[model samples]
Target: MDGLHSQQNVDLEEFRRRVQQGNDPHGPVRETLSRLGDRWTPLILMILRTGIMRYTQLLKEINSMADSPVSQRILTLKLRACERDGFIQRTVIPTVPPQVEYGLTDLGQAMVQELNRLIGWLEVHEVQINACRAEYDAH
Candidate 1:
């Protein structure tokens, strides 16, 4: 038991050192995950990837995702955060109803490439992930 514990500690220390060495063991990936992990953010980005979309269009797109239903208030908050982070830009048109469209900035477009890569990785490994989960649960 003590030997196993020591081995785990050594593994953890090695991971910490790797991260501290700017090996980016997780920093960039974690930062992106933290930003895009919000249920609506990625969905919003995916929707805007097609083209600029109005707030209503975003709401509808998000609603179609099914499992996670973002409320209007939450949607507003997520958009504001994304805008503040320079991930997305909001354009307000001078119209009677005040038309607002959201689109990805150049920075946001770059992020989409990263997101696409991550999604592709997940697609390839999804079965493995599910199998691991099943194995763990079976234990």
Candidate 2:
């Protein structure tokens, strides 16, 4: 029991050390994740990858992906955060009805590449991941 407790403490300390070392050598990676690591941010980025899109267009794209889609309010909030983090740009064109468009910035383009790489890795390993989950759950 004592050995097990000591091993747990060592494991926890290693975890804490890693988390505390955030952003020193990994500013870009950490920043990107911080900006886009949300339920809807990656989806929004993926949608905008094609080209600029209107608000309703983005909403529709997301809605088509899932049955219970993201709410307008949540999408708005995520967009604002992405804009603030320099991942995206929101342009409002002057018109009678006002045309608003959202698109990715250079930073966002880079983020998209990273995200695509992550998606690729997941696609390759999804079966293994699901099998691991099933094995764990069976125990």
Where in model 1 is the C-alpha error above 4 Å? Answer: 1-32
Candidate 2 on 1-139: residue-level lDDT in tens?
9999999999999888767766465465465667566678889999999999999999999999855889989999999988977889999999989999999999899989999999999999999999999999999
In order, the Cα lDDT scores of the candidates are 0.86, 0.88
Query: Best-fitting candidate, measured by lDDT?
Result: 2
lDDT for model 1, please: 0.86
Across 28-120, the per-residue lDDT of candidate 1 in tens digits comes to 555556768866788888778888999998999889975867899999988997897788999999999899999999988998898899999
How many residue pairs clash (N, CA or C atoms closer than 3 angstroms) in each of the candidate models, in the order given?
Answer: 0, 0
Best by TM-score: 2
Error of 2 at 89 (Å): 0.6
Error of 2 at 73 (Å): 1.1
* Model 2 clashing-pair count: 0
Report the Cα lDDT for residue 18, model 1: 61
